[model samples]
Target chain A: MFGPFRLTNPLSGGLLWKIPWRLSRHQKYRQRERLRKVDSIVATLDTALARQGESMRKLVRWKAEMPTEEEMLPKDKYTVFDRKVKRYRKAIHKLPKWTRVSQRLNPPGF
Target chain B: MPYFRITLMRSGIGLPEKTQGVLKALGLRKRMTTVYHPVTSSVAGQIMRIKELVDVKEVGTALNKKQMREARRPAPGYYVERRGTAELEPPQ
Candidate 1:
């Protein structure tokens, strides 16, 4: 006979998120779509400002500096540099609300 | 005078209250709902707070609720040009 389930998280004793170590193909596809959508939004905003002969400081900065989705490397796309994680790299999905937050930029010299 | 046309692309069902408050402040209550605001740093900052959940575009003018709905409506594929004459039409 089996005992208890013995599948409890020591810290919370609640539902624990079993985050995977690597990104799945579907997840990678979705992440790509999200990044591209943000890029297009920025592009649309920039064009709209040009039409009106006006510009927002942040928009200008974004257009000037932010890398497009196509420009990012595969490693950066799937994992982010984290000082706490082993080897200073962690899967992007491990972050809380990862889908609802943009983790595009990594710390320089990381 | 350009305005930011922001549309909520994702739900805030399980997100933090602060994030939900930001979306509420932007007048986005549900997914695919759009709101427009003049391009200001304060408004931009709010958008930044929930950027991953929205799709933003810059437009010269904002459309009203009716216009937004109309824009989303699909065109009819076929039109009835002739009036029906026979009560019992043969089935093809």
Candidate 2:
């Protein structure tokens, strides 16, 4: 036979516990919104980068297999690929650099 | 000074020779290999060449090989709370 006694729950109520439910709900919502924005940005960048990488790879393969001077293609053809390469290079440069420091960590003037 | 924390995320197995050369020049010999370099135009150019194959972050400090190794090491699950007196006993 066991004796019965009511056990008081130490964690049932506290000032610290009450504040977080309201504060954390709003904080979590904001965090999720920020994360979603970041995810979309990253997804877009990844797609663009992947496309650029594929085009660059194709160009490299074409250049590698292209004819030598003795068996050259037309001047316009060579120049077209050259222009494409230049454009790809420029686009790569134009894409934002992946350096993103947290605002809190960044220096005052940076 | 700002340093680039570059990790090779993909292999250069089928990539162009020049791309592979750039990876080698960056001191990244294999996938997941990391290297650090001072932030400079030259380093930026090198990274641009293989940007698609790398993950990069600008960090405030560069870690040496030993420090990098230590950073990747896992925490020990157990800790010794007391020392044993086995050494104090005579050889038996």
Candidate 3:
């Protein structure tokens, strides 16, 4: 009687135990995928920073070519340029903080 | 009221269906999406189910979607300083 009961137990070596094992394996795979995504976000942000830097340089060049401060481009144009520069600087400052946050969440070798 | 600031740091892909359901219930449809809920045991339990996939913070106030986006935005770097057409005229 004991032998038969032991054979039927879910914890006993059988197909039933595979369910939890499979579930855990899937979880691990998902975790890895998520970690990879964090890295991808960091990479894309780096490229964004490079692109923003180029645009900022172009804006500075245009500003330098102007004859005088009073004769600078229209107010709207100046505002737009200022906005872009501010956005770029803000992104540059924020990206590092985001990277650090992500790193803390997943950690290296995690 | 105190709130939990939950940001999805990871996706639920390839995970068990139930785990994915928990994320959806939390209103986290994509990575980096954040949501806030008042501190409660029910919400805490939901968070625990997917705790590995999110970063949680406690805050005194919750920010709406627009405020959250603006918080991430940067400021403009320069001011007009001054504006006048007379300065452009030829010196007399």
- Over the stretch A34-82, how does candidate 1's per-residue lDDT look in tens digits? 9888777667656665665666788777767778899988878889998
Candidate number with greatest TM-score: 1
Ranking according to lDDT, highest score first = 1, 3, 2
Candidate 1 chain B minimal-lDDT segment of 10 residues: B83-92
- Taking the true A–B contacts (Cα pairs closer than 8 Å), what share appears in each candidate? 0.52, 0.00, 0.00
Tell me the tens digit of each residue's lDDT in model 1 across B6-37. Answer: 98989988998999999998899999988999
After superposition, candidate 2 runs with Cα above 4 Å error: A1-110, B80-92
How high is the lDDT of residue A46 in model 2?
A: 35
| Every candidate's lDDT | 0.82, 0.53, 0.54
Cα lDDT, model 2, residue B75? 92
User: Per-residue CA lDDT of candidate 3, range A1-110, in tens?
Assistant: 47556656575665564232112445434434544544443333333334434223432342354223233232211122223453322221123222222222111231
DockQ of each: 0.38, 0.02, 0.01
Candidate 3, B1-92: lDDT as tens digits: 66778889868887778989999999999999999987655665576567557777767799999999999999878888677887898899
lDDT string for model 2 (A20-102, tens) is 21223454344344334333333333343344342344334423653323343222111222134433222111223212211
Off by over 4 Å in 1: A1-17, B1-4, B13-19, B38-46, B58-61, B70-92
Q: CA lDDT of B10 in candidate 3?
A: 68
